[model samples]
Target chain A: MLAKSFNIHIDNQDLLDEAFTQASYVNEHKGQNLKFYERLEFLGDAVLQLIVSSYIFQRYPKMPQGRLTRLRAAMVNEKSFSTFARECTFDKYIRLGRGEEKAGARNRDSLLCDIFESFVGAVYLDQGQATVEKFVQQVIFPKLDEGMFAEFFDHKTELQELAQADGPVDIDYELIDEFGPDNDRSFKVNVSIGDKLFGVGIGHSKKAAEQRAAQQALTHFDTEGDNLV
Target chain B: MLAKSFNIHIDNQDLLDEAFTQASYVNEHKGQNLKFYERLEFLGDAVLQLIVSSYIFQRYPKMPQGRLTRLRAAMVNEKSFSTFARECTFDKYIRLGRGEEKAGARNRDSLLCDIFESFVGAVYLDQGQATVEKFVQQVIFPKLDEGMFAEFFDHKTELQELAQADGPVDIDYELIDEFGPDNDRSFKVNVSIGDKLFGVGIGHSKKAAEQRAAQQALTHFDTEGDNLV
Candidate 1:
């Protein structure tokens, strides 16, 4: 089934199985001392980074490092990887614990992302870089050519650039409030441009909150006027 | 000269020169708009990640993903890369502006690290993966085999593990104080185990301060005996 899906020969069934296995599944079968996809996932994450970075580096030679970094960041993230995984129907094959399956973790973005990376790692181990590269090329390059990841620009950076485009202006992210238990805390951030409050956002972390705030600020600038000028 | 040092034939001297050219140097010669190494560094960093991760993944199959992650983080950061850069005499070849040259930026860890990665990127562009892999294998594998990066375990994680080795215990890092200008500030952190203060550390950033605090905490535990039990 895996061989047919990727259109590549995977000789090692054990590696493939390991790639699909999650920690929860392994924990459920602890006596067997089974391995999971995590190690492979780590390897595959690096593999993906190289493949993606190399592709963007070569494809966009004139693109600045900052932009390349942003592009790569946009591409090789949980959201994008999971989306790719779903496209290849990886969720259908993911081996989850009974509890996880009941909780619908098979379709979870984080899990799908891990499964995709682990699968890539498995392919690299089984077939080698040439085959894996070719596979990634086929899977990822088309979406990239269509400018799928262009939307994932860093909001904070975009805001900063916009603020500085006319002239330097003070932009600040202020943590206005935090709530919830210590373990499940959330942060509320208010982003201000000079004297005016442009946007406010809430997230699980300050960075996330700030990003959301910046995103809102960008949206504000999109519809509203640029008050900085 | 670079070809001689790496013992690989690099046909494109322009790419090689671009790898060594710093932005400062390019800025000094405005009309030329000569490309610098940042873009290549970005690409080379990814290349190095794949190469190093692949090597370590294959080498220690039983090593957990967490350990692999830590090890890779240790190996790929400024200290290790800068050391490797010096080994290749990269500092001698790095082109710098007069101001940077006088400021001794050529010998700086961050610059050296950037140059090394850019050099790898240049080689990847000129010679491709196999050649770059061979070069990195020669330069990096021996150091890795010697466990050069083993010392760089995340201090906070170490402290937490040590604190919990016998049973669950509270480990907390408190920001005791912060000082200096807004743009250039320092953080002071105190690490506490249970109710007792174990370490105090200072750094340019909160994370760094926390790491230092943890490092000191680990040292205290190592010398004064773990008080958790």
Candidate 2:
């Protein structure tokens, strides 16, 4: 299915087989000399990162490093990879132990992500990087053109840009409170423009809280009759 | 200097200049129409990751994904990159603001690391990935051959392997205490084999503390003549 979908060939059946083999299956079928996908996934992740980075680097020559980092992060995470895996219908092909299958590990996001990466790895191993690059271009670049991943840029950056679009404006994120135990700490933050408090948010990390606060501030700008961009 | 040292020619002098231009330099040299290296560094980082990952993946086919990750982490970080930057004498060529140069940003590790990445970016832009691969092979692979990065692997893996070399001893890391505020918390942990406590460690994070504990345990085995590998 992947071969037909991507229009790529894999001469090494072993690599393809290893790409879909889960550790559970190997654990259950010990002494059978079966390999798992983790090693391939490891290699594939770097391959995917390089291909995606190259694509965006060429596509958005003027984009800053920070936004590029954020955009790439948006595309390459477990959620996006798992979605791609499902599109390839890899869940049907993964070899899992009976226990893991019963536990629904076949459709699990991390498992799907690993499968997608391993598939890429297998393709790269069989046909090298150029083939893999074409594969990624076919599978991922269209979605990029559609702006499918643009929403993943955090609200903090959006708010900062919106606040400064008209002119120079002072935006501040202040940590208001921190609480909870060391292992499970929480932070509260408030976003302000000049002297007016715009939004308050609470989260597990300071960055998260600040982002949430920024999101609320953006919401305020969108809903209110403010002239802010 | 870079082209002569790497034996490669860059047709585009602007890209080469941009590779060495610091943000501070650009800030100070406003209206001169200058560019900085951050964007290129972003792309170069991904390129370097893929090349290094491919090299290590092929070099250590039997290595588990976890060990491969650790090994890659050992190589592709600020410390190692800065060391490589020094080997190339990047300090002699980096363009910095007057204040930054006076503050010794030329020799700083973070700056050096950025310079190294940007240099890779410049080479990739000029000569392409094959040239960059050869450049990295020339610059970084010899260090790998010399096991220059071997020491950077976390002690936890070493302790685990040494503990299990003789038998299937149950090794464990237990967090004893966590203290300090949310932003600056510290953890204390101890590693034990079976029922015997091997060592204790303290660090900013649990993983760090566990690694330190493992380091102490390795030292114990080394100094106490424990007949462990």
Candidate 3:
């Protein structure tokens, strides 16, 4: 299914093989066999942050740190990554054992999304940020808005640069609470520096929630007409 | 006051003036003004982890991640850092603004703690990890037990490494509310990560309350706060 969706011919069987192999599977396959996507995942994770940082920066030239951070959450979130896996046919390419395959591992969004990270890493080192951005636009940005991206890149980094000359400051975060049931709790967060509390945001989950808080912080800074308390 | 703390035999007033100047500060200011401590603080944040990791790796060959993490936290925490700063008289040499100086910034436990980070950074760069560990022992570990240091370094960095890895995980944190009279209300927090629920912690204030929650989360992951959940 994934093969037909992307229509990219699989010229390299080894890359696909590595992507599907779990650490357990690799161990059984042989001590002599290939290195898998774990390393790729690490590289991809770093690459993911860089690309997202770049995208948010360009999109939100004036947004504050907190807001931009919130928007970044909207962009580079896990749930969205899972959705992208289905769209890209990344699900089909993932390799799993008989037990996992029988359990619908290939159809599993989480598994497929992790592989996308490996793929992103591969794409990043292969072509650098420009091409990575293109890959992201084609694969990931369909559901994301430029506005959200702009908001998330909120000048936190900018604030950071500006604030450093003044003095050393700490980024203080306080997690307020989670609401609703176990699976569907919303999180509230507040971010502060010095005596200033700049952002407050809520998310369906904790990371998302923190991102929301970061986003709020950014927006607060950009609209610095009223001094944040 | 800071100058009064240290008695140095100066050959000439001109020499002292030159040493205080930024250009000449490099030549005779000892470790002062050569390179500010911030960069090292940045690197030390990670390098401290690497040191602790290796320390744990050798000490208890059979220990798992959780215990090691808790141990690390106890070692590097505010209380420990405060003591380290006191032992080294770290505040006496710090450069601060007139206001910060007048406000008794040197006596503030937190500021003293930050200086230890700067000192660690300085040591790490000047002599490397080996020297830094030695410095940690010589300066900070006198009152602390060997078992504590061993425990602290073992699992010390895991939680921070993990919670920070994918961002904050979804925590089902319930702010049960402010009980007692409005004048003396206490906040209660029960934070859960997945099926694991932390024991409730209380605070007299809301910000303090939330910090208690974060601290609960910290303890749940063991002191170093690895990604067990």
Question: Which candidate has the top score in DockQ?
Answer: 1
Question: Residue A115 of candidate 2: its Cα lDDT?
Answer: 94
Query: How many angstroms is residue B175 displaced in model 1 relative to the true structure, after the best TM-score fit?
Result: 35
Q: Candidate 1: lDDT of A221?
A: 53
lDDT of 1: 0.85
Q: List the DockQ of the predictions in order.
A: 0.63, 0.60, 0.02
Which parts of model 2 have CA positions greater than 4 angstroms off?
A152-157, A161-229, B152-157, B161-229
Residue B213 error, candidate 1, Å: 25
Q: What is the lDDT of residue B73 in candidate 1?
A: 87
Task: Tell me the TM-score of each prediction against the true structure.
Answer: 0.70, 0.73, 0.37
The models' CA-based lDDT, in order, is 0.85, 0.86, 0.55
Q: Give the C-alpha miss distance for residue B21 in model 2, angstroms.
A: 0.4
> After superposition, which runs of candidate 1 have C-alpha atoms over 4 Å from their true positions?
A152-229, B150-229
The top-ranked prediction according to lDDT is: 2
Q: Looking at model 2, give its docking quality level.
A: medium
- If the candidates were sorted by their DockQ against the true structure, best first, what order would they fall in? 1, 2, 3
By DockQ, is 1 or 3 better? Answer: 1
Residue-wise C-alpha lDDT for candidate 2, range A89-140, written one tens digit per residue: 8889999999999999998999999999999999998999999988887778
Tens-digit per-residue lDDT, B1-229, candidate 1: 6567678898898998899999889989988858888989998999999999998787776667766787788888899999999998889999999999999999999999999999999899989989999999889988855767545455787788768879999998999999999999999999999999999999999999998898788876532222221
Instruction: State the displacement of the C-alpha of residue A163, model 2, in Å, after optimal TM-score superposition.
Output: 4.8
Candidate order by lDDT, highest to lowest? 2, 1, 3
